[model samples]
Every structure is written in C-alpha cells, then in structure tokens.
Target: GAGVSQTPSNKVTEKGKYVELRCDPISGHTALYWYRQSLGQGPEFLIYFQGTGAADDSGLPNDRFFAVRPEGSVSTLKIQRTERGDSAVYLCASSKDPSGANVLTFGAGSRLTVL
Candidate 1:
C-alpha cells in the first residue's frame, strides 16, 4: 500500500474484553509508532519500533497494553482487560527517514469503544 493502513476502523468491545488493533505501514518504512487519541486531544505516543525492536514504550499507560512489530512492516497493539478508560482512537504511523526525523505518515486510526 502507498500509505499506512489500520484495521478495524471502529470497534466496540465490552469492558474487560480484549482487543487488538493492526497496522500495516508503508512499504520500506522501518520506523513504526503507535499512538492513542482521546476525544478532542492530540495523539499521545504509546510505543515506537525501529525495525523489529521496540525502541521506546514509555508512553504505554499500563501492563494491559502491549504492541509488537515482528517483521518490521506490520504491527499489532494488544489490549488486555480493556476498560472504559481505554476507549480511544489508536493511530499508527510510519517514518521512512533512517535518521528518524522525517515527517510521519499516519493511518486513519482504529476507534475503540469500551462499553
């Protein structure tokens, strides 16, 4: 794909249920990032993967949230024990610059609704 792609554009899950959001970054992009956006708020960085390793995951709010970029192109964000507070839009982005300074191309995001 020419741009970043995310799956399950909208998801509604009951509280305490689990959810997974998928992201397919643009071809050849090595830097992938996951962010969360609450209503009326800017995206908050959740994690960043440089290639297949997690370069940073400081923004993950708790142990219930985890993400992986195994092949360096696709990534998945897993949420366990989902809570109402977890309802938000999950955004995925990819940057092509090796220096990691290039502008990021972001996916439309997966909106999660926890009831």
Candidate 2:
C-alpha cells in the first residue's frame, strides 16, 4: 500500500492477556511512529523508528509495552498484561522525511478493547 496499514482493525482481550498489533508502512518511508488514543484524548506518541532502529521511545507508558521494526518497513507493537485502561486505538504513521514538519500518513488504527 502507498500508505500505512494496520492489521486486526479491532481486538478484544481479557485483563492480563498479551496482545500484538502490526503495522506496515509505505514503501521507501524511513520514519515510522506509533501512537495511542483513548476514548476522549488525542493520540499520544508511543515511539518513533527510523529505519529499523527506534529513535524515540520515551512515550511508552511502561516496560510492558514494546515495539519493533526489524526490517524498517513492518512494525509490531507488543503489550503484556493488558489492563482495561489499555483499551484504545493504536495508530501508525509514516513519513519519507524525518525532519522539519514532514507530513505523516496515518493508518486507520487498530482498536484494542480490554475487558
């Protein structure tokens, strides 16, 4: 796809379960990002990967949340010990340029519901 793509548009899990969300970015994009949005809040940045390396991960809430982009194109976000509060829409975005306000193309997002 020319834009970012996220799998499992909806997910339902019980508390304490583990889950994984996937994202595939546009071809040739060097910068990728993950964000999470709760019901009433705006998306909050979770991580940013440049190529296959995570350039920024300060936004991750805890060690239980992790993301990886081993090939620079496909990324996987892993969450352990899910909680009801973790329910949200996980958004993925990509940009060709990593600097200077370059526009990012965002995926429709994967909705997670923890019960």
Candidate 3:
C-alpha cells in the first residue's frame, strides 16, 4: 500500500459480538498506532507499537481491547464483548520513527457500529 490501509471501512455488529480491524502500513514504517475516535472528538490513542513489540499500551480502555503487530508492518485491533460504548471509528497510523509522531500517515479508519 502507498499509505496506511484499513480493512472493512464500515462494520456493524450486535452488542455482544466481537470484531477485528486490520491495518497495513507503508512498506517501511516502524511506528504503528491504534486510536479510537468518537463523533466530534479527536482520536484517542489506544496503543503504540514500535517494531513488533508494543512500546505503549496504557491507553487501552480494558482487557477487552487488544492490538498486535507481529512482524512490524501490519497490525490488527481486536475487540471482545463489544458494547454500544465501543462504537467508534478505529484509526490506524504509521510513522517512520517514534519521534515522528507529529507527521504520521493515517488511514481512512474503520467505522464500527455496535447495535
């Protein structure tokens, strides 16, 4: 992909169902991030992965939310026990370096609707 790419541009699920969102970053980006954005609000950081290891995951709301980047180029965000409160757009971003957070290339995001 030329830039960050996210799958399932839109997703609708029952309140208790699970969902997975995938992100394929630029070919050589080393820093990947997962974020959740509510309507009218800025994206909230969920996790940050530097290479194949998670460098910061403190922003994850609970155990139900998890993200991984096994090979450092692609990532997936998994959510279990979905709730209405979890309905939001999941944004993926990638940067060449952790210090380059200010210049991340973000994907269009996957919109999750929990009903």
What digit string (tens of lDDT, one per residue) describes model 1 on residues 1-115? Answer: 8999999999999999999999999999999999999999999999999999999999999999999988888999999999999999999999998667969999999999999
In candidate 2, which residue pairs get closer than 3 Å at backbone N, Cα or C atoms, i.e. clash?
Answer: none
The candidate scoring highest on lDDT is 1
* TM-score of model number 1: 0.98
TM-scores, one per candidate: 0.98, 0.96, 0.96
Q: Residue by residue across 1-115, what tens digits does model 3's lDDT show? A: 7989999999999998989999999888999999999999999999999999999999999999999899988999999999999999999999997664558899999999999
Let me know the TM-score candidate 2 reaches against the reference structure.
0.96
Off by over 4 Å in 3: none
Separately for all candidates shown, the number of backbone clashes (residues 3 or more apart, or on different chains) is 0, 0, 0
lDDT of each: 0.95, 0.94, 0.94
Worst 10 residues of 2 by lDDT: 96-105
All candidates: CA RMSD (Å): 0.7, 1.0, 1.0
For model 3, the local distance difference test gives: 0.94
- Candidate 2: tens digits of C-alpha lDDT, residues 13-39: 999999999999999888999999998
Off by over 4 Å in 1: none
Task: Evaluate model 2: give its lDDT.
Answer: 0.94
